[model samples]
Target chain A: MFTLLLVLLFIPFIGAFVTAPLQQRKADVAAVIMAGAVMLAAISAIIWAGGGRFDYSLAGLPWLTVPFPLFGIQVDPLSSLMLLAITVVGFLIVLYSAGYMSELNKEHPTQAEKDRYYFFTLLFVGAMTGLVLSRNFFQIFLFWELTTLCSWGLISHKRSSVAVQAGFKAMVITAGAGLFFIAALLIMYVKTGSFEFSALGQLPPTLRLTAVIFLLIGAWGKSAQLPFSSWLPTAMEAPTPASAYLHAAAMVKAGVYLTARTIISSQAVPAQAGYLMGGLAVATMFFGLILYFFQDDLKRLLAFSTIAHLGYMFLGMSLGVAGSRLALQGGLLHLINHAFTKTLLFLAVGAISCATGTRSIKALSGLGRKMPVTAAAFIIGALSISGVPPFNIFWSKFFIIAGAIQLNSAWGWTVGLLAIVESLAGFAWFLAVVHRVFFGPASPAAAAAADPPPVMLIPLLVLMVLSLLSPVFGLAIITRIMGG
Target chain B: MYLLNCLWLAFAILLAGSVLCLVSKRHKVNGPLAMISMAAAGLLAVFVAVQVWLNGPVTAGIDSLSIAGFPAVPVFTVDRLSALFLGLIGILSMASVLYTQGYLPHYKSEDPRRYYPPFLLFVLCMMAVVTVADLFYFLFFWEFMTLTSYFLVVYQRDNKKNLEAGFLYFFMTHVTSAGLILVTILFSGWTGSLSFTAIPEIYRQRPPPTRPC
Candidate 1:
């Protein structure tokens, strides 16, 4: 069973390898197989790990030192949840890509870029799995760099000058972060004489602090926190599936995961660091939300929204309370909700992009009459991200605010109130975009557009349903994983 | 001991295959074959990594070879942490290889098959950095990984944008590596041992010997 978890981690790579030789027609089939395998693996891991914290260890072989100082793998509740999230969301994104990529391919009949696009898509899933499942810093860094590389490839898949430029920018920013990550790992190894995370926690306070700060820097860069966040909005040049996978489900969330892990494993930082983290989170949330309101590009609006939500998670971490726990839970839960909701929105955008060849909100109107399913999915996603009642995001945002109020600090209250206002403002902006695009008079594009293929619509519909029902299941999962 | 040699052999084979493709002008099937070999080697390395992860640390060496009388015995050790990293390298490299299959075709018209094979070798270098127990070997693999990746980043060498991206990547990576090397040397200088196992006691016994800052 442990081997199965390991296999699940590697299966996407295997699937990716198999897809390399496949023809254009077979690429989608290959993608489905890989995605299905990931979903199955995730389900098995959840069952095997038994919904609570459990650790599985593999024996050392004779070739390597039996107690190899640097080698380890463990699956606890947190990682298990992450694994499931990556796989489930990854599967849907892959499904959505089949239609989206096929449509893009048709638009460029003279160009033969379909095979390369699908291949990178499959590989991205595999790289993400590696990232979430690995147990030590070294492995994490390796997988982290892999994601940067894969992202660059996917972002540049369009072969356009703009796409290439955007891909290059993303690579530099992320790889810059990757350097800090390697430095942190080496420093930790030197200080503690061990690279395993389990061992690092046992190190002296000073050493632990060193490791934590370095790791936090790395995480902040990857998660797109404040000063390092500019690359995320620019990353919108890629196809929608790439955007969905990179922004909502996998890449950006890695930062939150790192911070959560560091906080859990290490002792608290000094009050200064806490305040610094908190201040940045607050600023990022407000700045990102404000910027989101100014975007005419539908996907860019969502990109800014992602940055803002990431800010909320960071703010929750800085608060440090029983409130922090609830806040973290809210933050993490919102991650799951955002994954579904944002992916749905991106898919809808992709469908519209396909029909009209534009993502400009100003140019799109009355699409609801033509692509009603997509329009409806977009509405649900918009509502969910905006924290409207009964949606999963609402519950998460509610807990975040509740956690803030519990802190009883004036700053906490202020940030919490501002967060709510910013969230509502962001929501209104999204609603305006949806109404302007889907509900008003038909634009030239909407008048001629038809529904996207079933391959795409079905996935969007499933995500919509998941968004609707997530609060019920999300609460249960959080309870089980957090030992509540 | 023999198992350790086999691991190195696998990596060496991958390295050789990469070089073979780079030197060959024909460019047919070399890229895919290089990827396959690297993938297989990565899988095998994963098995080794899992073992170390479960048990603790495993060390193996063959003494027959002599490198300037320092004993040319290439040693491989997988500690609990290194095993995790090894597994990650395998998984990541495997995926990259798969993507390269599709990604390479985009460059096939331009005869850029040389890039894929070298990229696989670069993966091996990264794996080596995580698993090599000796400081010298670790540094060797670290530099190799950086250089190889630098080349891969410049796959679009004719394009100024790609060249600039590659330059930035190289600059950032080397700077980080310098910091890492300083840390590694500091610990080794203080402890007088390059082995990972020997450094913990040194750090434990000597408090504030050198401030980390």
Candidate 2:
């Protein structure tokens, strides 16, 4: 089973190696094949993980080991869930890209450009896979930086000046944040003589707090939380699939994943620390909502919404520290639900924009008629995200509130109040969006628009229906994730 | 326990009556539905108040549902303090819902049924805030109350001034809610418990959290 994990993590890297040299049109086909392979590997890994936890260190392999001998991989219910999400969503985005890249920026893309795009996309798949499976923070950070590089590459693939700038901003912000994470890891190494997560408890209380603060800085930067979140909206200048693939599905989740792993593995989380995290989360969520209200660009609006939901996840995870297992479950579940909902939204919007040649909410209306399938996917995504009941995001949001209600602390109540306000605001915002953009008479651009090919629609439909039904399955997985 | 059950019964009646208002095609049916629900809730509120006044603060709470060993907020906590407010609000709500029978024609909105949801939501949040024992739930319901009021104000956003008023109303309520949040935070910090019942013990302590920081 451990060897199965290794194979799953390496499969995408091998695919990228084989994919990079292929010709343009063939590369798209090859990439889809690779994506299918990756998805299958992830499903198998999920099954293998259910039997038991896996903690395999590369330290025994003399040639494969890093200088610090801290390279390794691990899997639990949480990692398995992340693996399932990244690969499944990753494959869909790649398949969508196959249809999407047909006409790039008004010109048919060259073979070299297509190959290059798939190369980086496939590399991202492998790196994110290795990232979640890796046990050691050192290996995780290495894979983490690899993903940043991959996203930067994909974001700039169009070679437009705006694309270049967006890529640069993403790289600079995430790498800068990564520096804080590295510093925290270094401090842990100095204190405990090890870089593994299990050694995180050896530090004294003050050092533990210091490491937590720095780790949170890194997480916030990576996740595009407030104050460091501007890069995410700008990164929307990339192709929509890239935005869906990197920003929504894979890279952005790394932050919350790190935060969850950190708090859960730590010896004990002090109450005041939970308060500190809760306060940051509230501020971040507020910023995300305020940003969301003003976004004219569709992707940027999704970006702001993404940032806001990241804060909600952190808030739940923080409450988890105060001994609210419901919060932990909700936070993790939200993380997964956001991944699916957000990616579906981005991909559907991407298809709409590709067909209509516009991504502005104002420029596009009455799309529900001609592009009913895409419209349905978009509406479902929006409703799920806004915490509407009978939708996937709603259950997680409810559980998060339940966690806050359980916390019953001053910090808990404050977060609970803000969560309610934000959820209500989201409901109104997305509902108004649906009414304006989809329900009204078709604008000229929307009138000319057609639904995306079945290649894209199938994935969207599958994800939409699966997400709608996820709440029932989520209960069992959440309990398993809590390590019971 | 009987007092608590009576209070819950009143809540159920009000909520059920609000849902029943949806079935009516005419104002005649809906207005009386509203009145009946409010009147039933008011009667129950009066009963709760009398019981609390005579018994000197009877508390009823449930602690069965928890997360990670942290107990959940009590479903409802109706001591003398909360019971008094519930009774007063119930009386006010009954009068207001009755007044809506005649006043329904004056408000310039189609489907006057829209008013009742936010109105009932407002009343429910108010009752919930007072009746909740823990600080967390109190703040949550406080914000809910504030939000429902904002919605009610903006429901008639036919004019620029109405929108402006809604915005201002939202801003002011959040400021007050922020203050309430801060107060609860400081109270929990000093008292080490968020239960309203613990305030007296904190105040009676020898030092009484004298640092004030």
Candidate 3:
């Protein structure tokens, strides 16, 4: 088990170094294989655990033990589930890029930077996997900062003036917010003499509240939940697959996962802290939903959708901290479900641009007949994201709403009611976009468009079925988690 | 175990046919292979599902391969719920694979490699997902079914958009699968076993939460 954990952790880092020197073709193949290997190792770890937890730490990490066991791995059901999502999604993205970054690509037709793209992408995957498995605050922080570095590299992969500025802006905001994370770590260490996640529970009342607030700021920034939300949309300047991975599966998820993990590890978190989180999260959710009306670019619209979904997660987590296990389960499930849905939306847009040479909702129409697979995939994604039934998000969102109602307070009712309003409004807007872009009569751009290659279509079809079936498994897991 | 025998036989035919599809160079040959395998499997699935529906559940134990650490675990148990889903899979798999026979002629530029193999494997996985009694194997086949369908969705490799669509499709499915997997673990943790057989006894012993309403 320990050996498998080590392999899972090191394989991507090894791939990053190995792929850096290889030519483009070799690098792409190697990176995909490497990601595939990481995914296999993660699965092996799951089988090895056999429904139990594994906590493996090196006894001889002498210098690294200043405040914590920074070099250990903790593979509970939570971390294992996260590891699977990260590695599996990472592998698919790399496979997609093998075709997506080629000269055949109509959206951005150049094979100029495959090595760099694979290098940073692999590093980002590694960092996310590591972050999920980290047993201590310092370890999580290291992986956390590594993710910020990788996003900077990936977001600016094209190095256009706009891309560079967007990348710089993302780095400045996230890394700046990361300072508060480390500061919180410092506070925990000073007050409790440990950097274990549980140390937050040991801090005195005043400092504990302060640390929680500081951590929330870090989560907000990384997740791009309002006030820190601006960078995500601009970060859309990155290549589509990178946007899909970073925004959907990796970077943004890191924020909420951290918050959820912290809450899970700590005890007796204050009611006020939960209220602050719930309040900011609801505001962010509403704020993101309102901005959906303004987006012309498909990616920007999806970006706002991501922001709103992240807010949903924060709301769920806050409710969990306030004593609703169902909400926590739903929040975690949403993290996984939204990754697939939002990534599908982003990549669908990528496919649109690849075929039609434009992502402008106003510039494209009647693409359904031409690009049937993409159109179908997009429709599924849109409906699923808007909380339609039998799709993935609907189930998680249902639990979250139920959780709010279960809270049964004035605050809960208000947030639950507002969430319902947001869901309906989001459905309306997404359906509008779908009708205009896919269902209308063909414009010139749509006339020339068609479904993508077998390489790309495979992932979309797989995701479509996943969207449909996710509720079955999502409910089972959440039910068991809540002991229902 | 007669139904179980038919199920295993169908699985073998599909697996063998898919391997042939991958290796065969001629589209004409691949089409017939896919059609034959899918038809045989679909008939078997429907027959087994009907048998289970009429005569109660079908149960079988694979002496060779049990879920790891749980040696007595049954590998195939088709209860009514599984039978219903299996029947659906049978109909859909037959219809889609048969449809592809007519569909393949239009895409002259495409390779048969992209479609027939994945289609067969997709069917096989779907069949396995419903038939497997262990939660782990159910999820494993469920995920495999998702993975194989991806190849079918992106049959047009030249259109970059299809590739993007495929990626998006895959990203969503793969991630959601992690949920079912987690549920399986939780089930095992609670029941001390990985088979569906353990579920009823555990639930009987411990009552489920009452719905608030």
Candidate 1 local Cα displacement, residue A368, angstroms = 1.1
DockQ of 3: 0.04
Among all candidates shown, the one with the greatest lDDT:
3
**Candidate 1 per-residue lDDT over residues A65-140, each given as its tens digit:** 3234333456666676677667888888878777777635333222246567666766777777777666666767
- Backbone clashes for every candidate come to 35, 1, 21
C-alpha RMSD values across all candidates: 26.5, 8.8, 9.1
Instruction: Indicate whether candidate 1 or candidate 3 has the larger TM-score.
Output: 3
What local distance difference test score does each model get? Answer: 0.71, 0.77, 0.81
DockQ for model 2?
0.04
Worst window of 10 by summed lDDT in candidate 3 chain A: A475-484
Residues A54-169, model 3: lDDT tens digits: 88886435553455455788887667657756887788788878878877777799888789999999999999999988888778999999999999999999999999999999
Question: Residue B8 in model 1: shift from native, Å?
Answer: 68
After superposition, the stretches of candidate 3 with alpha carbons farther than 4 Å from their true spots are A59-68, A471-484, B1-213
Go through the candidates in order and give each one's DockQ.
Answer: 0.01, 0.04, 0.04
How does candidate 1 score on lDDT? 0.71
Per-residue lDDT over B1-213 for candidate 1, one digit per residue giving the tens place of the 0 to 100 score = 544665687688787777667655444576667667877888888887777777677777544321221111345787778788888888887887777667676664344543766577787787777777665456546755765786687665445576567656655664454444444444544554556666677868977666788
**TM-scores for candidates 1 onward, in order:** 0.66, 0.70, 0.72
